[model samples]
Target chain A: MMTADERGEIEELLPWHAAGTLDRREAQRVEAALAEDAELARRYQLVREELVHTTHLNETLGAPSVRALEALFAKIDAEPQRRPGTAPGIAMRIGEFFASLSPRALAWSACAAALAILLQAAVIGSILIKEKAPGSYETASVPTSPGTEGTDVLMRFQPQATVSDINRFLETNKLSIARGPSAGGIYRVHVSGAKLSKDEATRVLNTLQQNRIVGFVAITH
Target chain B: MQTNSDEVLIGRIAKGDRLAMQVLYGRHHVQVYRFVLRMVRNETTAEDLISDVFLDVWRQAGKFEGRAAVSTWLLSIARFKALSALRRKPEEELDEDAVGAIEDHADDPEVALAKKDKGAALRTCLSKLSVEHREIVDLVYYHEKSVEEVAKIVGIPEATVKTRMFYARKKLSELLKEQGIDRGWP
Candidate 1:
């Protein structure tokens, strides 16, 4: 038998267990208890067996020895027909919302959406196209200097970070705007060119990293 | 009265037969209502919950995945409606007298023996369990939802369902034992 605490737990479990709601751990404990204890098990079975015959609503249905089915259907008919979606007018109105969108607007939206998507895709695609070197540099857009002397770092900006702010940092550090749009969502400045001084790239990358938009940065040779 | 098979009626429901809705509601509503009634332990709330279950079935009948038995799916809906009703309250609970009433309501022999035997005792003792415990068993057995479906419907993790069923069956075992019924069957 379950202790007061155990029984209390068991008591709480009985409803769902009877209703079939117990979580696996609690259920396992209940089962083990039943398996070990005969009285609890017996009570469990008796309740399980009795669940079907209960009729609470039949209090209304019982006495009429007359057409119970008709009475039930009568009740059904009397119910507030909350069948909103089933009505022809309502369903047609919803259908019209789908129908009202002319093919022209949809096609136009699709093309515009696709074009914008492709642009976003291209920016990311170009960035990822290079073979990444572990803790090393792989520049997608060559700097005017074309020298690997400047440290390469990768940075990601926060949502609120603006491309202009990123561009300002790039300009200050002599980092050339690489594959990313200096005008778009994120400005990825590659300070690979000759103008970029030794350790200047790292310092600039670190500065950008502190910026709210620039959430992360990685440095490479 | 012996009811029509859930499988046949369900197929008709899928075909958009309105009468199938009526038949399905007429046949299963009582059990579904009883299940909700036991969990919520209120007559009017149980009725509303029953209607909610049928309304869902009516709207989503075509969406039935047929992954499990129709009765199982119906029970899953019933369990969900009941739980939603249960959650709507601030610290809502089933009172002892209300629960006792459920047990007493089920024990009426005329009602139990209607199809009798295994089904009746299941109802009576089911009321004896706590609202939380009874809810799971009602969904599992009376509604016939599988553990995964029950878990999803109840919005708990899946493992919780097995545990609920374990304790539920233990309770059922005790109830059945009183009637000399052995659930020794697989």
Candidate 2:
């Protein structure tokens, strides 16, 4: 008589054996046991039935609607693309490089970075005050700065445009990303240096709209 | 793209290749959707969860170390997302239409027995299984995953996977017996 534990062991392997996922040894064992045990053979038959039923059940569940893929792609388009070479390795290497610096050198570097930030902040504050001065005609634009109060423009890049194409376009236009690619793939690009007058801003917007790389551009007010 | 191995596709996806993402999604999205649908029992939620699952795949493709088959990896992610979704909305009920459909087949023991289509009866019983038991059955039988693969996807020990599979089958047998279709073993 097959021991209870042995029967149980073979019983568990029966499903895998029916599914044909068992390795040779386990398959052989289960087959050998099936030959000897009528009860085990009956259980194996039931496993086969369950396997068939389960397969049919899942097959009937069907595929998700195409809308699922459309939504997925839209989310993907909105997500900021991680550049090819900017894997964790780059961050780790930078970490190692900083770790290798002498304590004194690191402290001096930190101090220099703090001083630079303070100087940039002072310049930005002065520019903001100047923009808001007594007789200045206030523009409806949201004040964002790349070291100075500047007009933020909302622009959508062409889907086919590569990151390099975007970087080159931004450089050529002297615009910096202040925020976004929001859910709509619109970026808030800051025109650096002086804020533009309404006509100059409209002219810049018209120019951006004409570029093949830009699909839409609007002066954010 | 169709011929590229899943690992190769994942490598390309890690580099922000949208075409590769589309290919991988095409290859596996149905299975992932079905798996999540089985767990959540709602089509809309399953559709939403699948989007989240593939989005994770797109974002974390670089983290896939090829220790598991791509299908297994996808199911693992799907399982995690489904379970998290279930937890967040714990009171969410089974899809009434699905339950009604299955019940129509097996709810009346006499009707089930009269139909004499053991396959339909078996399927209705399979649907009646607890989430844990149903998942084990589906992964092993429908997905044809190995014990190790099921363990990895379900995050359980291989031994537990076997026992769970055994119990799931046993429970299924008991369910069949309730429908007056005994297969003669405990």
Candidate 3:
């Protein structure tokens, strides 16, 4: 007694139902229809036969090249981290990278940190001293190199911004450079303060976008 | 015993763990490579895209929203990249190998289902299915994807997926019929 339109709809769902892809509710409905309908049951059997044929056919594809894995590993090593548009596993890497550092490396890192603090203090003092001479500031990016260890984000240089403008911008934000000014003029910048929360990263991107010396900033790690 | 799930591996991959990436690549690379090879009909391009697909996984593992299984997500990414690669190639360039792969089947209707080689006959008829039909069948049967998953991966509506499946099923049955193997249903 099922209407033709109703049967057609059920028929359309039959293959998927047989293939076991339907949601539980829909599968149950198909089961209910099939129990009462001989034609529907036959269609389901045909779908099953087709499925069997296709599955067997796909098995004939041979395995891929043996060199595929080696080539993939090489390419991964060669390419710098391109901050994905999605969330990156950066937080975990930061922890692991630091944990694996040797004691000597840790001591060297501490000394380097001290030197950086001193240099930053001096830089800030210079900006204060030159408060009256704003245009005389040095042009330095936040993270000054392309592939600095521990640095993962990227920021492109704005077309017309002067060095002094970039320096002033960094000074105002209290951000430090990790590395860059690659041939293409992109800088690898460190997130100022602690690890960047999602909201904080978005805010930083928005802030950079508004700054005249920054263009196309992104978290690439 | 419980195995480390793909989600857990992706979590580690997001953190820049190369080992995690290698583990994931080992788990899914072959299926992905096979899928790509089937589509492009070129081993070199298929191999190259396998790297590209896994590289995207390594780079974008953090973006996975868990809306679909990791395997499904990987296949979707593979499908997109394969289609893009296909579009970039000249149409005439696909002429020989891809076309020949399908038409090379024996034309003799008498031998279509010669009971001694039904499996081979089915495979030949399968190769003859249009790319669209072949993909639908592959998604449903070989990949074991649900209609919704197939719809998501193929970028078609659920209804369209069913319709495509119906036609693909019909076409496959028709091809089998031509080869003397009608299964008495459709």
Q: Select the stronger candidate by lDDT from 1 and 2.
A: 2
Winning model by DockQ: 3
Ten-residue stretch with the least lDDT total in model 3 chain A: A143-152
As for candidate 2, its clashing pairs are none
> Model 2, range B52-140, lDDT digits (tens) per residue?
99999988876766678889999999999999988887443756744543433334664455349888878877887878998999999
Which candidate do you rate higher for lDDT, 1 or 3? 3
Q: CAPRI band of model 2?
A: acceptable
Give me the candidate number with maximum lDDT: 2
Best by TM-score: 2
Q: Report the lDDT tens digits of candidate 3 across residue range A12-71.
A: 887777678778867887899899999789878777766787776566677777688888
Give the per-residue lDDT of model 1 (tens digit) for B1-186: 232366556545555566977778776666666666666766666666666676666556555555565666776787777777778855436565464544343435543463354455555455566666666665655554555666666778655665765666576565555545566531
Model 3 regions more than 4 Å off: A81-221, B1-4, B91-97, B101-118, B183-186
User: What interface RMSD does every candidate have?
Assistant: 9.4, 3.4, 3.7
DockQ of 1: 0.10
Q: After superposing candidate 1, which stretches have Cα over 4 Å from the reference?
A: A1-221, B1-16, B90-128, B139-159, B167-186
- Per-residue lDDT value at A82 in model 3: 49
**How close is chain B to the truth by TM-score, in each candidate?**
0.60, 0.89, 0.87
